[model samples]
Target: MSWFGFGFNAFGQISGRDRDGNDGDTSIVYTPTEIKCHVDEKSEKSSELRASWSRRASLHLNGGRSLCLAGSNSPSGICDTGCTDAVVGESFVILVFPDRFESWDLDSDEKIPIWSMDVKTLCDGAGSPFNLPLIPGGYIAMTPPFYRPLSPHLKATRLALGAKHSVLLSASGAVYTWGLGSHGQLGHGSLSSEGQPKVVEALWGMRMIFVATGGWHTACISDGGDLYVWGWNESGQLGLPSRAVRKAPKYQTSEETVVTDLPTCGAQPEGEKDTQVFISIQSFPALVDITPSSELKTVGCGSRHTAAVTRAGDLYTWGWGQYGQLGYETSRSDEPYLVEFFRERQLRVVDVTCGAWNTFVSVVKKEVATS
Candidate 1:
């Protein structure tokens, strides 16, 4: 799949610059632009666009395919082959091989000989801050010899961790959340923290297929492709109404398609249909509408932004754009809007991944429909 990236690239991470063979380019990509895989080390698998603080990496089933585009890792023998899985964090990178796992510190460029063991595969935990090996009780400084699974079995299909909260999607299409919920991210219609994994009652009975958590927000997708978001909207990350977004400078709207709405989380007070419910924080899972004619294919979240691909191959983004993480180069957006770069180029977006401050998309040429 073709790749396009936009947002923070201070260290050439998103640009993949030097290795990408482009010089004299700025660090931040103001808009969605094409980017090529420029691994210093050869990888057997296709590139999986990933971004971390001041760096970028591409991983595959082989593990740690390319930790850093032009950084060191080749000298180490573990990544050469036989690695089964990998996990990337803000400050370091970890690779899990059948016989051992190695950790690398990106900041110090230190080669740390970590745990050694023969393992089959690493279970994915979340979308960003990359996925770490998780245990029943999180916040552990180290991995225990034998970890315990969730009590009485959770039968979870996916697990996502936010800054202070955790979200779980059960195999039965139910969404469960626990930990910090002061921001209404738990979607229980309140800001009360849940001691145990509590099912989001507001979304009960809906067959949710996917779930994600941001810094203080939670989002999910129903099997039928409806998108639901909640929690903090301080920066409009929830796609709900935002005061910051409404105050965006006029320049940001000069030539962009900006969608604006009353700050409401899909509610109308009794006999107040015309009265918009101003919402700076969504206390429950609020249904968000993007592509009217089609359903969402997939969705992802950044630290303060959200993105999704529609079944019709269109990409939409909302929330913080100070670093251009929204892909539209606007300051901030309270509602979802198309990333016109792809539409103007006739590229059809199929997938998207959000970093702490960057966004990556997988695309292909749009199929031409004819009589």
Candidate 2:
């Protein structure tokens, strides 16, 4: 399968080409470029194969049965292989960093991949070797022993990470988040950082099946095909009404008057009194009411923007667009505007991936019939 990348290529991560040896070149890639992979021509691309990116990129094959990592040196030894060696097996839990790599099989929780002192030299400032014990019901610190078993009642189906935050979607259709919350990205109705995963109580009773995080924002889709968003909105990335505009004179357009009658989570305030509040930072997940009423299929997020594909094969983007990442000529937006680029060509967007400051989308061209 082919890959594409954009933004931050100083380490040769985006180009997927050798960077004149180990010390990569110092150039930035502003547009999408096809990334070269070392896969054999015999291997077929399956929908089960997918990739996720942090500062580096990690490819998860067949739902974590096998894995490959790319980019500069990382804490997880996976990067040390430089995408050469693929870790194969479902019993393993892998955690990678820029300079270190760590893994553990369910049978042996103490198996440490061999590496030098750079990444494994110190842990939590005590000069402890990088060691992780994948045991159940244990206290976990940020560094070593990073993996911990969840409650018996919870079974995670997917996990996603932002720059400094994380999202977990459970098989039971529950959503949990943890990590940096300075920008109210945790969606807990408060901007407090969490060390452990916490359920987003504000979305109680709602069944969320998918979750994605941007630099400082979070987005998720409900089982009923609705979209909910919260967190940073500096550039209107959350697609919510601006704080300034909500406080201004309320001009009820004919369309707005009609949408007000719809039954949505954000339509009415909760609690003792019905006090209308102007929210600048959405500390809680609020349902986004997009027009034309369509069920959402999938969602993705960049550092400052978000994207989603609808059941009707339409693509929508919002937030920072200074680099045209939002597929629009405008610089920024707070609304989920539809992008007609692929629709005009009869191509259906099947998947999307986002980098630190770029967006990548995969489309399937519809077959034409000849009479």
Candidate 3:
């Protein structure tokens, strides 16, 4: 219910202070601190925080039926089996392994239990077993990945990730995508790369509820709010002023004699010129035009920047703002910029989050109407 963190904390993962209480510059905090939640007298407390990363973080409660994780310590088991550091129970899935945290068990295959001290004396069956001191972290549960592939009835409501690609949003609004599509980011206009989940047929009838991803680009938010974008727009971050890959003129068999490789600037300056050029990358989803009445409620991404939040709360930002994180002082932008520092103090930024370089906002102070 209360958490806040800023970008990169070398490894203490936002000051969990393992390297001697972080007295020696673990690197970068730049503001928004306060993210310290740990209380496991042996597990069973998480209330819900979902997912995060600066080092690692996760939590869940009955809806997901209990789950927990807490930063740094994945010794190459590839994030999730024996969760090499911090772990919590019931239906595991947590994955992210650049430095720590791993899990798997969705049902069980046995190998679990690794929080040491002989699994806390086999969960306190007691024979005087209380020497617990392995807190350097690591836990191992098993099971999970059976590869259902989708279509049992198609129920996913929302999910997004985009360094490697993956988007899924169906509760009927349908819009699915699968891993790494080179650059098309799986919108499917074609950079081709999918293993299973597919659906985005140029947004079929269009319903998309919400989705976001950056590093390679992909964004979606429509029920009527509208705002779509596609794969990597170099720095425009898909506010789309221009970053293209349009070269479609392949043979339509005419009688007007049309030969083509289509690149001629040699001798034609008379009256017709619409050759259409620019090839930076944008495979499919493209419809970003904020302020045609502004309705967006949420969207986030950063590995290249993008943020949105406005059901009247206002907070917009576009790609790569160097270190200012798009709040201003401008280092980069492609259009959507309205960060006025909590609208100059009346405060109302409801929510926005990102951290490939930094950005996190969530404000609320605005009530005043005295007699």
Candidate 4:
């Protein structure tokens, strides 16, 4: 008998494990060619596994619609989509291992060719793939007209993979958004969703370093260390006081009541003299510049929760904890709270990742000194 396993690494590398726990020496590094092959193979295998499990799990779970892994597997080095199939739609979710991409459709149980171009073709000037999987109940939508052209010198680097929603940072420090803008996550000054990518006029030339999107809400970090949030604030997830959701982006000033409107301060250019504010909100805002400060280095967002890692090797989390996703043995909350499990430890955290509910972090142990 042979044991088989599939996993993904922090650097977006995926691998397969056979009975011997060794499978072809890590799949030829992380190049475009190897990545495509890895993804295709994984997607095929995962689709087959899901088809088999859907039959057994649905019967046992009782009224269970489907199964989905719904978490990031990159850092854990383990990739599994579980099983997902429901009357609303009959489709099997496929993840091409190691490629860090996924595909699905309503018609068939087998995986389909969502992308025509291979990795090499995409990397060159050929074209890119469109593999955005549809969210369960969400429908296809588009955003209103808003445009900001990129600098002629900065060629558009097409997306290597297709995502229903993506946070794109341009070379000129602007953030371009597209896909599923209904929740105002696109930051296009409206609630309409968009199929094609559009430049966020609000963040035009702002030198945004990072951007993140939750189911509906969006968050971003400026190069100046200030944090901005917009979209759904129903649970005070925007770190704002009001319950009303805003259709445009707003800056988070302090730890005030739940905010629902745009920030009092407008978007400022990069070199402006502004007080630095670090406001952590539910879901991924943009990637923050953690270099200047020695406290934290990386951060990530889950469906309704957020996580961050400090340079000193500490981890913190806030928001919904229903599934023990916060790594704290407690119930969910509406306020941001520190995860006590890693408060005083000196572990060296190398990476962090999040899924809709679960969080994964990689760390290296410190060597102890002996007399």
Candidate 2 per-residue lDDT, tens place, 176-256, comes to: 889998777898877789998899887778889888888888999998889999887766778875543344335534333
Lowest lDDT 10-residue stretch of candidate 3 = 126-135
Which lDDT value does model 4 have at 102? 38
Residue 109, candidate 3: Cα error in Å is 13
- Candidate 4, residues 59-102, lDDT tens digits: the string is 01112212233112211112233222211111323333222333
Question: What local distance difference test score does each model get?
Answer: 0.68, 0.59, 0.56, 0.39
**Against the hidden reference, what TM-scores do the models get?**
0.78, 0.63, 0.28, 0.48
Which stretches of model 4 miss by more than 4 angstroms? 1-116, 121-164, 224-226, 242-296, 333-335, 343-345, 366-371
List the candidates ranked by TM-score, beginning with the highest.
1, 2, 4, 3
Off by over 4 Å in 3: 1-91, 95-183, 186-189, 194-229, 232-237, 241-281, 284-305, 308-335, 341-371
Number of the top TM-score candidate: 1
What's the distance in Å from true for residue 20, model 1? 17
Q: Deviation in angstroms for 117 in model 4?
A: 3.8
Better of 1 and 3 by lDDT: 1
Which window of 10 residues has the lowest lDDT sum in candidate 1?
139-148
